[model samples]
Target: MFSNTPISANHFLIKQLPQATAFIDKNFKVVFVSDKWVEEFNLSTRDIINEHIQDLVGISSKQWENNILRCFKGKRTENFQENYTSIDRETRWLKWNILPWYNENESVIGAIVQAEDITAQISKEQKLEQVQFILKETNEIGKIGHWKYNQSQDIFSSCPMINNLLEIEEDSKLTLDEYIEFYKIGYNRNTLSMAIFSAMENKQSWNEKLEVLTAKGNQRWVNVSGKPLYCNGKYIGIIGIVQDITDYVIKEHQTKSNEHLLKTLINNIPLHIYIKDTQSKKLLANRSELDHCGISNEADIIGKDDFDIYDKELAQKYRDEDLEVMISQTPMINKELSQENSDGTTNYFLSSKIPLKGPNGETTGLVGITMDISDIKQKEKDLRNLIKVSSEQNKKLLNFAHIISHNLRSHSANFSMLLEFLIEEKEEAERQKIFGMLTDSSNNLMETLHTLNDIVTINSESTTNKKEVYLNKQVHKTLKHLNPLLEENNATVITAIPLGTSLQVIPSYLDNMLIQIISNSIKYKKPNVRPEIKLSLSYVQNYTVLSIEDNGIGLDMKKYGEKLFGMYKTFHEHNDAKGLGLYIVKNQIEAMNGKINAQSQVNVGTTINLYFNEEN
Candidate 1:
């Protein structure tokens, strides 16, 4: 059916061939190329006729060229597949079938080669390999095992990995009943049984996650899936796969538990907690923060910003601070902040803000907590006020003692001079007059000593043995004792002290001080004016202040106001004007942790104010 001529001589006939065919000589030179080869592989017969195959194909793998060599030496067909990147940078595939050609001398001269475009085929084959690899890897990673249960024999055929998945002995195949026992009874076993029955009766497939217990008494979670197998319209068996999911299940449960705990702690605590999105400007505020913002529902506040709830200025300020937090990406700790409330009041807080980070350590947003500090700030203010009052008391106490010493020295000098005069006199009448002068001087010295001792006693007692003392009753007792003196001066004491007036103070000191101050008004009355005193008690700024007004010869306050309470500094001309009375009054009030102030005008009147601290 063929000619005995060399295949190289039939080049003219090869041009009419339908398949892509090329003939190469023993020396690997191209002998012929069919018209189909030129059209299919894009080759030129004239250009490649006498050229070496290496020069035309431009193939670099010398070892891969062995197919051509084998065909050149033998009268046989060689099949090969080749892939390479083309000029357009796409991968091209070719399947080559090379057959040796013979000459009339019965010797192989060249080979006829046929090439087919197989790019799509090779691409599909590669994809299949990749899918297989993925499936195998998934099964291994998930610790999956496959099984088939034959209903006829009530037996299960399991993969090698099933023993590991179920924690059973190696190489041991279990019966269907034994495998069912591995499922934790109650819910887990019942579910599996129902699923199996559903698959058999309703032709349904099941994919469920459930718990299991092994022979070794270890519990685990498993992902199970099965499909029922049927033959001749009758249920035959079931086939399925299983995966151990204990670690994944446990981890998921723990994560949810931790989230619940954090939610409880955040909502229940007193601090205002919040989280904010850096870009969207959305806020997630906890329960305490919601209450602070006067919002009742979480849904109402979610996805909202400060602008939604606060005034424009406050919202802008809040956003600017958020920007600062994002830029710094560090903790902003213990910054004092004040926020205005809906009721026109302001609340203070010690706020701390910190940035939230992503998995790659990039700043994502910010979280903050604010502790209310208004009460602490109020306490601090009260402490400062108390310190100021204590300092003023110490300064006046020093000045008060110095004035008392001066008065003592003046009285002692007068006593020494009078005594010396009495001792030197010799005449009987003169001696008698000197004795009377000595007696007056001794009484004055004794009075000075008693006043000085009272001042010392006032300074020594710091804390009072506090008790409720009735003010009106004490005033009554003093007035009764001074009735004789009041009668001699034709004085009237009009008291506005509430009938049930009461205070917390030392009883004896309050009684003595009240007597001295009340009598002083009577003693210092103007020469022509009747002795009139009005005493009243009322509350002023948490203090019970007693006011004693008298139509007395008041001194010029512009001249003596500064030393009005100075010991031995007398403003009025009176036989009993020692001026120690008011000084001693100041000390007694200080001992009770109270205050006294006197207001006077030129011979008009006097008002003595005694301030007793109370829950007025």
Candidate 2:
């Protein structure tokens, strides 16, 4: 100790520190180890200090050991990774740094080394790489990209695909404001801003579609979604994704435009139109419907249920029908409906309701249209009435034919029997009496046949003979023709004819009609009482009114009201009362576009009013 002790120089002096360290001696034995090495190997320093390096670290592979031995033989090696087994029989990764050591005379002594357990770090790196690879594959397949925003830093970042979707350069850096500016100028910006704000402020998530202007000045559609990250009630910036959807957007717009055009065309049609939901009894109507209901605008009726807008009973009936259509899942065409509106007016509609179906052919709703049919309905009613009248007339004609045949055959048979009896008898007196009776009967039969032929002709001919004639002059002519009868009945004819009163009529028919009517009045004059007949004509809009009032044996209209104009229907049993007069008069007047009606009582008098079309 007195003299400088000879230093037993060893490369293990630097390598055998307390921290993780390793050493190789001149003979390449692991002669030194640190505390971490001792713990790692599950051995004492005394046990591993003098062991060969391969045995200490359990490097059983010859190839790996050769590399380590070569490194120890003066070849400097740094950060070499290899698998090694600890004393506990657990294998793990270890990294070693190796350097050759030398003595003062520059002779190679051994090598110094440092080792670190890096199994956890290497495993984490491998897992991260795998996750990144999977995310790349998913992004490519889905055509989606993730994006992030940092509010505090005012920075926006997106994955590469997002930039591609927006047609932006890969290396472009965008702020949130700049990114929002890329949205189209109209509703797209508003919708996107609302979605983003809701997500960031309320810690919510939203998905929406928006149009964006791309770098190439082309517009594109994209589906965007975002979710806010909140920590302790404080909102962090949003993370989201965007997907290109330009094709879908264009298709949707085209479909909507077509639908709108269809609706517009339907609204412009001049008919009542409406639609209804299948299950709910509600009406969706158009502008024409508003006009039909006498309302100024759609707001007057829109959203009001059928019960509120229509009569309760009618609404219920309509709802029941719609329910049936929906249940049957069929189309109903030209179904007639009589509906009452809110204003207490009724309308006729020809309706068609079709079931709206889902992809599976299940009924989801109903679409209905109603066309205004009020005018058509009116025309149909008129046609039915005409048919009824024609049927009645046919029956009357049949009855008339039977009467004529029976009367004629009865008279002929009587005449033939009388002649046969005359042939059988020889008395000249009896023969002459039979002859007189036969003559009277033959005369009566001939008169009846003539009347029947005249009626048949009048009925068969068309009643459209139209011409302009002065009604006042016709009345004066009729009165003049009846002057002799009036004189014999002590009748007084007073006329009150307005100047220029005329009507559309057949000239000859009108004269005959007036003659017949005036003759009847004078013929049925009260006996021992002077008959006073008043004839007055006045002009009304579209018509000339002729009123003939008589003071005579008034008719009992209650008994012979409907038969007044019927052939062979005589109200008076007078010798000259043919009953054909009024019948012919009515037929002639009606044929000339005129109408005649009578009001009478048993004792008072009769007033006959005739309306004729005013000459155009």
Candidate 3:
């Protein structure tokens, strides 16, 4: 009954506490032990309760007792980190929190000791510290920097790499302004300023390449990226990383300079230079093309295709030619092409196109050079025409020689026969008539010689002599020169000319050509109607077209078309119609590398079209 009392029950219940609790007497003996202590040590509570403290725990007896005695001497201590070897000989770290206890009279009795296992936490912290040291060392070796700016404090903090990158001492302090001042001139400062402003005002991030002057007075290129930090929609500051890229920057600049030098060399040449994209039909043309096409501004023609600036047929022809060059993967030289402009002007070109190959030896696009050859083409045409004219003249001269020889032989024969007849018959009238026939035949031979001399003179003049002549003024002058004849024929002349229509031609030949046409129009006036002649001139394509139409007794072209321009062959019986006018007109036009064609009907009218090449 005494053991089962409430006091004993209370003592048993107190002994069942979850923690390791114990009561030690003045002799340092364990007087009471909780169930937790017994279970943790694998000892019976009754057995440990009566054991001495030094014997219960298997640590060094002196060190263990000293720690317990020190706690009981009115001293309090907590978390004295220590290591203990477990039963398995594995070392474990522990923290001991020991507190001294006392009675109400403040006399020290014993202590409460709490031990916490801290091995895992301590090992984790050690590994993390090692990793951080490695990262710092790597940043220093790589010359990379991490930086942060605090707007609230208006301060900047940088890692060791930043100090090394700027060639500043390790202990040096740097501000944002000082950092900005390190940037080299031009884009560096501007880019940095823009980036900072954007982050501050617009909350934008930026990545840029910049040039900076280090403290050692050397210029360096760096790639920098800055991002703004925000907390609760409030702007904090910016953090950024910078990498040294000076070698890459220098290489890139050199490459760009080389490209520009190549482009300049290409542009300086006389050829029309152009570049095309491989996948797209985009083109970049040089200055030569702009000038050749009469374009004043580069923007006006940039990014435009051939169809945008040239005639439809001509553009299609250009595309087809380019496509062939691209597909064949062959370089073409001196390829002849004709291009018509938006104004209907045609240009002859000798072009060369070379495929632009890529690193894989595949055709990427094409580079082309075109040389204007209108002059060359015209010269070739003139040479051919000269050959034709020479052959025709040679034929005519041979025919004239035969006719002269035959005439001379016939005349001598006839003279001999006449003399024999005169001597035999002795008729005075018949002899005199025979002599007169002989004289007439001699005069005809003399006239043929004079005509031949004139033909030679006409053929001897040079064709290429050119001089600037105003068309309107030349027309007026020609009309004035033929005013008397025009007035005599009762002709009404009408003229329609736009201003500033000037041309490059041989002035004398042009005047002669105009005079002949105008005079012929008047000379062939109809019987009943007063001759009305209209003269007009305008530019068409690259050539100037001059038209002369007359209300006259026109010819039946079907009957005499082939002989219209035959030398010394007259169509009309007019005294001035030596047939040489049209012949000379045709020759002069041909010599000047121009063209002339006539349209006529029996009773309607005649119109002659003259086309002249434009001057460069």
Query: TM-scores, in order shown?
Result: 0.64, 0.49, 0.35
Rank candidates by lDDT, best first.
1, 3, 2
lDDT to native, each model:
0.80, 0.76, 0.76
Superior by TM-score: candidate 2 or candidate 3: 2
Higher-lDDT candidate of 2 and 3: 3
Per-candidate clashes, comma-separated? 0, 0, 0
Model 1 C-alpha lDDT versus the unseen true structure: 0.80
Ranking, TM-score, top scorer first:
1, 2, 3
* CA RMSD of each candidate after superposition: 8.0, 13.3, 17.5
Per-residue C-alpha lDDT of model 3 across residues 420-516, encoded as one tens digit per residue = 7767767778878877877876776676567556555555666557778888899989989999998888888888877887777878779989998
> Per-residue lDDT of 60-108 in model 1, one digit per residue for the tens?
5553467767766784645778885543455778787877676667677
Indicate which candidate wins on TM-score.
1
lDDT of 2 by residue, 9-124 (tens): 54345435655776566665865566777766666645776688767766666645554566656675546787777766797888766667655756556666677788898888
In angstroms, the error of model 3 at 98 is 99
Task: Report the error of model 2 at residue 129, Å.
Answer: 6.7
